[model samples]
Target: MTIGLDMMGGDFAPLEAVKGLQLYLSEPGAPANIFLLGDEAILRPLLATHMIPEDRIRVVHAPEVIGMHEHPTKALKEKQQSSIAVGFYLLSQGKIDAFISAGNTGAMLVGAHYSLKTIEGVMRPTISTIIPREDGRTGLLLDVGLNADCKPEHLNQFAVLGSLYARHILGIQQPRVGLINIGEEEGKGNILAQASYPLLKENNRIHFIGNVEGRDVLADKADVMVCEGFTGNIILKLAESFYEMTHRHSIRHEYLDRFNFEHYGGTPVLGINKPVIIGHGISRAPAFKNMLKLAAKMVKSDLFDQMQIAFRN
Candidate 1:
């Protein structure tokens, strides 16, 4: 399987992307077929300087890069040679089976959604990435920024989609789905969360665990956590901050290594017609390459078609 990576999409650009690529290569059983998309003029020397094998990696020269400051829609429309844009086009054309980008999040979202389109009947695509929890098990959070507002039906579909992801990726047959809310009680949330609970419960497509509070996210009450993009993003930010703050005292300790968000690589923009994974803009080479392995794993596991049917039902 081929994973097309946008080398110029993030804060560190090609350098950090090279780190992630190294991680992917070092991983046992990782895919070696990678298409690096960015300016070859700068990248070639970096590869030479690092003594990275030229035969194992391929470079697709893309001149322009979609800057973080550029509007997503406008850049996607006008920047034909943009790294992210061209990488996504390669994804659509099947020259590359999956795509990994650490560039502009908004541009990645916009490009992936419209370029690949959503699965039939999916209103908005989501970013589902695995997060380390306190209880030794990880959790899945969706709509991390894909849709600010969601209806009962959309949340219900997210539940199904997330469950399928958990099952396939986490290897859970009956992954519990939770609706994020202010309280766990029935009808204890805002109009959106309250309304989503009933539909989630009624849906036989997934195993709904009713409502779970943001505090329970790290506690591992449910395997697949569901919330609107606005709420989910806030929760993710807070959890990340808390994790880092709590680990501040043990920064030098090897035994007490805190969970690093970078270790999980990137979040796949779920529901896209093809696999499109988005890494943190600040991602270095290690995280970037793991994101490529993830896309390979997704294609290998057939999560796209599985989710397409899971929600279709």
Candidate 2:
């Protein structure tokens, strides 16, 4: 399998991306062939300086880059030669199995929607973050920042999507699904929560465990937490800050380390026809390595095929 990487997407640009390649290639039985998308003039020297194996990778020179602050739609349309644009183009044409980028997230999302098809029964594709549980196990939370405003049906669909991810990617069988809400009881919380409760409970595609409050997020009460992006995004930001603030103060702990976003590499856009992993803007070598590992697993496991089957039913 050939995987594409946007070498110009992150804050550290080509350097960190090249280092990430070094890390991945150093591993025993490296996962897949890599396609580096960026300026050839800059990437070639770094690849040589870093001693990256030329046989395992190919470089696709993209002379342009999309800035973090640029509008997603406009940048993609105007910067046809940008790394992000070219990566998506390769993915759409089946030249690559998956795409990874730590760059402009808006551009990544826009590109995925336009370049790839959503699963047949999926209403919308969602992004999810890994939740580090207190019990040493991990969970999944969906629509983290994708759909801020969602209807009851959207949450219901997210439940199915999140469950599939947890099962295939996280290796959790019969994953328990939970609705993020203000209270544990039925008919509690906002109109969306109330309306979504029955739908989740009735969805046979997932194993629903009723409502899970904010406290349950870290308690391992649920394996797959479902909510609209607005609430989920707040939870995600809060979790991220916990790590940042604690690390900044020199607080050290194993649990705190688990909160680091680099450990998981990046978030993959679910419900799309192909795998597209989005990394943190500050991702480094470790994050990039893990992202490639994730992409390999997703492609090998036939995860999307299972998702298509589940949604069709």
Which candidate's lDDT is highest? 2
Q: Ten consecutive residues with minimal summed lDDT in candidate 2?
A: 254-263
For all predicted structures, in order, the TM-scores are 0.94, 0.98
Over 4 Å off, model 2: none
Clashing pairs for model 2 are none
Q: Please give the distance, in angstroms, between residue 157's alpha carbon in candidate 2 and its true position after superposition.
A: 0.7
State candidate 2's TM-score. Answer: 0.98
Model 1: residues with Cα > 4 Å off, grouped in runs: 246-258
Q: List, residue by residue over 1-313, the lDDT tens digit for candidate 1.
A: 7789898988988887876677677677776488989999988988777666676689999989999889999998999898999998998888998888888999988888778878887777887768687776788988786788888788887888888888887788899888888897997988998788888889898888788886788777999989888888887777667657757865554322436777778898877678788888778766876688778888888687887776574
Best TM-score goes to which candidate? 2
lDDT of 2 by residue, 212-308 (tens): 9999998979999999999999998898898889999999998678888678889999999999999999999898989999998998886899899
CA RMSD, predictions in order:
1.8, 0.8
